[model samples]
Target: MSFSIGIVGLPNVGKSTLFKALTKIKVDIAAYPFTTIHPNVGVVRVPDERLDKIAQIFKPEKITPTIIEFIDLAGLVKGAHKGEGLGNQFLAQIRNCDAILEIIRSFENPDVENVTGKIDPKNDIETIKVELELKDLEIEERNLSSPTKLLQSKSEGKEEKENLLSKKPIIYLLNTDGKTQYQVPKIKHLIMNLKDELEILELSDLEKKELGVKSKLDQLILACYNILDLITFFTVVGQKETRAWTLKNGQTAPEAGGVVHSDFQEKFIRAEVISWQKLVETGNWKKARELGQLKTVGKDYIVRDGDIIEFKI
Candidate 1:
């Protein structure tokens, strides 16, 4: 799936630095405010060690990792809702994203001038939240303002109404504690209510470490994947390398095969599947097959995480 996360924050908040760190690619970072008028897009690799084990097991010729795209949109000013600072266009760039990674200015560096003239992480976070809430509210208002209600059939109208009422989920990212102190403010005055309403996750340091296996970059991407409810499966051909494949949770075998190649899906016969645990115990595919530990499944068999699947075509 072409899933993506939109990275948004005020100017000079280190969104570009985070993007560069995540994607390991260089992008234009301006020294002053409003430097990034156009957002930079990057695809970040999702780290998985299961790929190594599967490679050791089946030894596929190639390994494929999953990725999520991130776009660093221009900074939002105080009056973003009022069409200030690339306002509406920036919001529109984020509309198609699966979710948002809100970057709040949580760091205070004397070198990095605060356009607002002060450093307050809470205020920074609240500013972004209020902007997004207003953006969503505007969307909701537009949906309500539509006069062509009769154009849709009864069922479609009901579905549309349901959609207009439901809130889009967001994941809040407080970019590494940057010297700024955390201070709690009044719930109503802050963005706490909006965050709760949207079920937004305020990432904590403990959670980040626990989620990643090695690197913080790896952990952040893993967190994003789990947050999006994505699943990973394995494909091991009898080559030297093994690969990891990602599919939506509950995807069927043929559909999963389609992720590898449409031809694989078309020519599929049956899938010989073994769980990672079974492979670890059985030691090899031949042993697993001999012991009938390998499951011979049809298209309906749901692809699972860590499944070493050898598609029969």
Candidate 2:
């Protein structure tokens, strides 16, 4: 259930700034290329309103939300696959991630250097995509050259087809200047001024609203969650803790239990399940059961988002 997202793009595209906003972990955000030679990693707790509401109802001592790790990798250039700039080092780091958040610079600043010479989001996107595709082609060719090694990988339960970097899910982040007119590429993208977001990051909610600053960091995080097709389930232990857990979509009850604990899957019997909304309306589990809102589900039951489950092991 734990996964990572690689924040990649051409240099000076605000990747590190976005990382700082998402994680509050400062790194070298120079206006030049290769500022982030080594990847900076930080774990971010996914924001969930459901978990907050559940905590308000249960009044638990501890509240735990699911998390996603973000890695700020060095920038890629036009020939990254051919050892240009940071080259394969950046691509290699990206391959290890579950998903990619590609930052496309659409902002123009005289102080900030543009690696691509001019601000063209479409061209920037193509540059990154082609590099990834070329790198994947290289990997595929290398695997074909060593048939024995390729066979070994397949025998070890690795899907050679899905191992390609281009095959991974990608979400484009258009780093805008808030007022500049830029060509928006025809792809899945979110627009935000990374510098502005960082400036307003420490301000209170009311202060942010007063300044007309709308932060899209949460939306970006949720987009990453949705891009991976993940769903969340909750567990509330009376007055002790309320926790949110992540699972892939279409997973079953036993699999959900496994997320809570490895042994819960094998020793699982049945689960006491109730929708989070129903639990909130009924005010308590005991009352929900009394009103016949709680249901018992077996291993075959597919877990739904916002489900509060009590696993029987």
Candidate 3:
């Protein structure tokens, strides 16, 4: 399963630096404003220890972990709603993302000019919020101007009335200097020194320990998944391949199957279910079934996090 998140903030807030750290992909990073015109998209694997444990037990030929896509968008200035500084293009890039990762700069550097001339994280956040809200209002206005009532479907009408920008969930990412401690913001957020972390990635294992650089990618992934209300389930295919899948918190068995394959959901029969812990305890699928640790669940069964499933079609 896959998810996409858009990285947004004022220019030179380390948005590009964080993107490079997250994906380990080099992109142009400059101190001046409007450095990134188009967005850069990259995928980071969801770090799961359970997949490793399953691989150990089954010794699969191939192991696949879930992934999340991150899009690094250009900065938004004050008049972004009026199409200033690639504002329209930034909005378009972010609209396709599942959620927003608002990158807030907490550190001060004289070399990098702040778009507002000074760092005020709260004001910076409000600027982006208000601009996006204005765009959402425009969208609503266009829908309201439609001529025929019969032309609008119920779902589309309801969606049009909703403010997509305001409705999209946000995960605040505080880019810090690592020395000054700041009060945690009210919204869901995680603090990290993107520059420091990225530098650490270039070091050897021993060097990392000396610098005390523990990767924050795992924590970031966990925090984002929690904010999005996501869960993971696993499928092991006869020692050949083991994979992790993502689903919404309360999705049903068939819904989870649809994530794997379209036909799996349409022709889905009963699903064999067992908790990962139970499978580990039993040591193998055959023994787990013999011990009654595995049970057949129907389409109505709600998929839980860390569930190991086998779909019968």
Candidate 4:
């Protein structure tokens, strides 16, 4: 039920700055390598406008949104697979994450040192990719020699069944200067200036609009959802609370119930479901039922985005 994304890149690619911007958490940001020796962790709420609309209709006493954790890991360098620049520790930190957000620097600043000595996005990407692939190969080789090592690792909850770092979902973020022209890579990528974003973080919404500053952090979070193939559902507890939950795209009703509580999944019966939009349009549960918009679904029901579900156990 918990999901996380690891932020990684070469030295001084704004990994720590991006983390500070996204989570509003203060971290050590410097112009040098290994500024973040230990991984910096922060939980970010998954942005959902649907949750806001539902709360408006229900007038609940409390509203809870689903969240994802972001970890700012130490930068990786060439020969990282062989423990270059604290690479082994950094690589180990990322394996526990469900996805990766790689920061690719396209900005040129003489003050900020580029460990690779150039501002080529293509080469930078390749360097990171090769290192990750080599590390995965190293892990695979070790696993082959001692098969029980993997089993013991799983039992201790220190390793995943699929241990390849390259196999994980990755999103490349091109940290740009907004002035230079760079060739966009043919992969899942986004462009933004981390410094500019951080500057506007303290500004009011009106101030941001007046300055023509639009934040892409929301879009970045949504992209994480897409890469993970996740969907959102809702639960309204009378007039008390309305909360949002996340599930895999094709997950069934019982699995969704389990996210809320284990007993709901184990003693499952049926679910009273209605799309959030329909419920909002009709104004209440009674009106939605009167319009025949409410649906009763069994355990086999695949939960959809924006569905307001009442689980029967």
TM-score of each: 0.79, 0.98, 0.94, 0.95
| Every model: Cα RMSD to truth | 7.4, 1.0, 2.0, 1.9
The TM-score leader among the candidates is 2
Which tens-of-lDDT digit does each residue in 164-243 have in candidate 1? Answer: 21244456665544234666443322122221211123345576457642234566677677766778887765775576
In model 1, what lDDT does residue 310 have? 83
Ranking by TM-score: 2, 4, 3, 1
Better of 1 and 2 by lDDT: 2
Write model 3 residue lDDT over 1-313, tens digit each, in one string.
Answer: 6778889998889999988988989898998988888899999888999888877879999999988888989998888878988888788787888788989888888898877877667778889999989988876666568745325644466444333776788988888997655555676568888888788778898988887778887888777776778899999998799999989999999999999998899899989999888888778889888988898999899999999999999
Tens-digit per-residue lDDT, 89-168, candidate 2? 88889989999999999888878989878889899999988999999999889989999989998999888777789999
Question: Comparing candidate 1 with candidate 4, which one achieves the higher TM-score?
Answer: 4
What is the alpha-carbon lDDT of model 2 when measured against the actual structure?
0.92
* Candidate number with the higher lDDT (1 or 3): 3
lDDT of each: 0.70, 0.92, 0.85, 0.90
- Choose the strongest candidate by lDDT: 2
List the pairs of residues colliding in candidate 2.
none
Candidate 3, residue 273: lDDT: 94
Task: Give me candidate 2's TM-score against the actual structure.
Answer: 0.98
In candidate 2, which residue ranges exceed 4 Å CA deviation?
Answer: none
- Candidate 4 achieves a global lDDT of 0.90
Clashes by residue pair, model 1: 59-239, 60-241, 107-178
lDDT for 256 (candidate 4): 94
Number of clashing pairs per prediction, in order: 3, 0, 0, 0
Candidate 1 lDDT score at position 135: 73
